[model samples]
Target: MSDNYSIARYLISQLRPGLQLGETVLSPDGKVLLYAGTILTEKHIEKLSYYNCEGVRVRELQSGVGMGFDSNQQRKRGNAEPEELIVSHEYYEADMAATVSEQETEFAGIYGNVVKDLKRCFTIVRLEKHLDCELLQSIVDALLTLSERGIGATALLHTATRSEDYLFHHSVNVGILANIIGNLSGAFKPSQQRNLILAGILHDIGKLEIPVHVLYKKGSLDEDELHMVRQHPAIAFKFFRRFKEIPESVRLGVLQHHERDDGSGYPLQTAGAKNHPIAKVLGIADVYDAMTSKKVYGEEVSPFAALDTIQADSFSGKFSPKYSTPFLHELCQTLIGRYVTLNDGSTGQLVFWNRSGKETCLIRFSDGQVIDIMNQNKLKVIKLVC
Candidate 1:
């Protein structure tokens, strides 16, 4: 075995009955193979005897003794090829390690200077216009790297502080999500992707102008407070006008993200064709992060659930029809083949998309069993595991 082999690789051999440490298990050709982890109990020996395993031998590693099996007997029993077994172990280990590393990095990035920088942005709306160009570029670069690695930007949306820190995290997450949407939709060239990122980063700049109390309120807002909230887009637009170098697409996204396709939204209340494509994409990404985020008043919804809400609301004319359908479809497709932990504590991969229905499709086990959740009346998806 290679010195670098992971622990998972060492545990891949099939078990047989009566296997004992230090005893030689022989093949039909009298070759030795397979190792046992420890001395076999009578029950274990009986189980392997039923499988007709010849005998067990033990080999000790740095950690402990491993039981060995008869090679010829294993071949007859249809054991997986050694190469295939090793590859499977390696793949599993790599995936688990990457996930752990990502989680660590996300938590670390949430502290100290990074948090201070984000908090500063939240406290001053004008900072959006004056934001260090290099820093904005660095954030965009990091997002693109994450996309290439198939890591969800949502993983970076950490809420270490219960205050208005979510606003800062939300802003960053929206930026990353918007950039991803733009890239996936083919709405921009490589050169334009950064601009979309910037548009996403600044889309909610006007919210900084809202009183911190209103922004972080634990209670429901009254009608007058709600009206004040509606003026953010106009405030954002005014702020953007001061920066001549900012792209028009970015400026438009900041001003028009609040406007609905059906003219039900606020600020300018533009209808139909008036909303820009980048703005529409930004609006979708922004709402998704907000709805799925945990707050004082409510727990976060799953991403899949948020997607469903967006689709339902869009079909009801809450958003522009021109962009909503394609956007939702792409979002659903992006999530296919991903694993999610259901509320019932079962983990399964998302195998299908039910575009027309409320419940999505899932494949629950390794046996390829199909569960059409849309028709499964007793069960519902309660969470989306990253």
Candidate 2:
């Protein structure tokens, strides 16, 4: 094993179950094979070997020691093939090593309860083709109350480590995000805000109509499969049309959530003003959660990365600038004073932003060293440490 700060690179033969990755593992084809924070398993090892992967970088123990293997013994293995090293810039999270805060614990509890409720609600909708409006309303109300208490994207990201079902958790998170965007936009009244949250909750309901195998497929989808997947928005729109209790704006948001302002979106290819305001907010919230939430098929990115992507898209006319601007600004302010781990394996507290460049920020490390992470090519903020 070769050590770089708290990271150790291990050959496939040296990998063992329970070892957590410190960076992403990609295939020769440039597709992500395993994400950072993934605990190694026998299956994962087999997959890595099947792909002819060279090595993986794993987290060192909190005591600054390598986990268990002897580096000399690993090097002496005669049959082991030479591994071509690859550089990774992705952030890593070792929740086991970081200290959890009261807010994280609280969010986890709330997330667990809401996910269970959402699962049950989805099951009922699937069997009866009827949404239990009161039950879903209660769930959204609970999420709104939590939103009122003030929770940030970082808290939501860390709390997701305990969740297993991506769909249910994504639904609840989008609801919360939509509500936050609504509150920040100041364009919606109380009733409309509740409806927008409901819209977010039901935004991906059409995905349930898709086959499980297709919905959770490991890699790329064929053109036919992609076509089927894009039909989700239309399916959801038709289903919601049955209920008069749902507002027209809420239904429109569900249908057009995937419809980008630049006409790059699917289904109807609707552009700019053709999309509903609620849909516009839902679109931003949807992408943000999808990028920041841990999933079975993809890795969750840091909030800073997600914000950067959104800002770029907003500038390119894909997302509405009005909502995206304030949302990004608020999220940056929320990240201040929070703990973060950088690509260099150093943990620090985020102090402030330069407010000039998207990636420029100040981080104060444990040794009282404050870094301007501005033009440092190797230094990147990787993950939020609770």
Candidate 3:
């Protein structure tokens, strides 16, 4: 087989039976569903759809005589010529819009289930004052599985609305975000990554111990109440200490997730190397989720704004650059190709993003005008429409 084929991305909804995969498709758990160069069939398409795969990379052949798929067969099957099979911009946009909607709906269902399970587990632990490691681990495992669904899962984080069950939603979002950061950092093994996610999930579990009135108060907290809220990490640490299933690093991470590199954060005021490695990653996730999530106190911040904050913090010594660099890099890739509504009341597709030097984006408008948003300070992304 010739290695000369190019690869193109296509939404699962746009996939046809005669197309050949340019890359292997894997399940959330890393199980291979199909191999590269495999000629797709009705069964293959059905299987891919069954997995809720967002999209696939298909081979664009010079002449589909190699890779076990013949162009002639595709034509005989009443499919379009291989050269004309490329997904058009309009087609991609239409298909992706549908895909994103379906993904968000599916994600909402999964998220609701996990949050319910987490709330139940929290209730059990709070009443019994006992840590059910297995139960909590099961919830965490479900979250990890959801987080492994690729970029769509990440985008789903923003789709979630702030509800009265803020704690549960926040915890789940942080866990998924932490897992993404860990994977992007390339600094953690699989075991360490799991621990990082576990830490994120349980980081705010201590808040459950705080008085409801104090925790949910809409107004500014008094000094005493603020101090009481700050102690949740320590409180959560004490809870995790009873369980041997929770790794020592996870305990530290939960305990010091608020700790900053500059020693400005709560409870311990641990600085730089004094903070556990996992704690640093958790801190970024925690802050990002808090800022991006809609709040009763304030409107949700745009993700581009959140990224800007992370970038600024990375340079300010509050967030470690090691993890923030890769997190921003990977996250920017996901945000690209998304449609956004600008502050100037214009809607366009984000065609280019350059986070280096200066944070800027190139948006291609419907009138085919490309605008560099950085040149127009008043122009900024206000919302992700799809």
What TM-score does each of the candidates earn?
A: 0.64, 0.72, 0.74
What are the lDDT scores of the predictions, listed in order?
A: 0.57, 0.73, 0.74
Candidate 1: list runs displaced more than 4 Å. 1-116, 122-134, 147-164, 320-322, 334-360, 363-370
How does model 1 fare in lDDT? 0.57
- The residue-by-residue lDDT of candidate 3 on 44-134, one tens digit each, is 7898999999999875645543222222221121132544322234533542443333435666888888888888888888899877678
lDDT of 1 by residue, 1-386 (tens): 32322222222144333232333233354332221222343444554465566544343333443322222222111132443222223422332243333333544454333445655655444454465555555656665554432223443343332334676666666766777677666656888777777787677777777887786677789888888888887887887677676788888888888877788877888877788877887788888888777666557777778877888778778765455566666556445544455554455445455566464464332222345555555445666543
Which lDDT value does model 1 have at 341?
A: 55
Where does candidate 2 stray beyond 4 Å? 1-104, 150-154, 161-163, 357-359
Least well predicted 10-residue stretch by lDDT in candidate 2: 83-92
By TM-score, the better pick of 1 and 2 is: 2
lDDT of 3: 0.74
Q: Rank by lDDT, highest first.
A: 3, 2, 1
lDDT of 2 by residue, 1-386 (tens): 22233777888888886465666566775445554545455766898999998888876765665332222322211122333111122222333333344544666787678888888989988888988888888888778765663335435555564336888888888888888887787778887778878998899999999998999888999999999999999999999888888889989999999999999998999999999999999999999888877788777777888888998999999999877887887777566545677765567656555465465576644333455676455667787764
